[model samples]
Target: MSTQQPAGGRFQTFSAFYPYYVHEHSNRTCRRIHVVGTALVIVIFITALVTRNGWWLLGMPLVGYGFAWVGHFFFEKNRPATFKYPLWSLMGDWRLFFETVSGRRRF
Candidate 1:
């Protein structure tokens, strides 16, 4: 089933999209991958701060997305929300990452 929003419309709000986000990350490996990706993003952010190189900020999405997509392709075996909802997918990525790290998420 296509989760695509209808033309000239926005997708569901983050709250509504949350359950689907959790469903997409149901696999433990996927969850862990997201965690690592999120950590890498933080590292990149720190590097950017220390070096004062704004370009390093670009690496955040690269680290976050590259690792997450690898997990989806090899383990979750599903399409990434990036293909459908780029911003929300990124938000969901970080949200899920924190949830996993904080032990608030059930695998």
Candidate 2:
């Protein structure tokens, strides 16, 4: 895919980007890690709200990216989608999380 973009580097809508995201995470373990990571991020957000701690914000990317990267390195044995599609990767992470949790995706 071409990395070049328009003048402002605009992006397509999330819906348009989602399929590409799924393609990037074709590995099951990598997708699973992304789901777990997204859940942890939600928990962290709630904890941050309850505790009013600024540091919890630091955990957002860490929890989301850390588990995901580990899964990619160990199980998927492939580079992460984040490197090429940061925003869509993040959106896909959460989308995959919800889809799995809601039973939309078979285990």
TM-score of each: 0.84, 0.79
Q: How close is candidate 2 to the true structure, as a TM-score?
A: 0.79
Query: Taking the tens digit of each residue's C-alpha lDDT, what string does model 1 give over 1-107?
Result: 33444468656588767677777877889888888888999999999999999999998888888999998999999998789888898889878877877889854
lDDT of 2 by residue, 24-94 (tens): 66778777878888889999999999999979989998888899999889888878868867887777787
- Worst ten in a row by lDDT for model 2: 1-10
Compared with the true structure, all predictions reach lDDT values of 0.83, 0.78
Residue 69 shift from truth in candidate 1, angstroms: 0.3
Q: After superposition, how far is residue 36 of candidate 1 from its true place, in Å?
A: 0.3
Off by over 4 Å in 1: 1-10
The numbered model that scores best in lDDT is 1
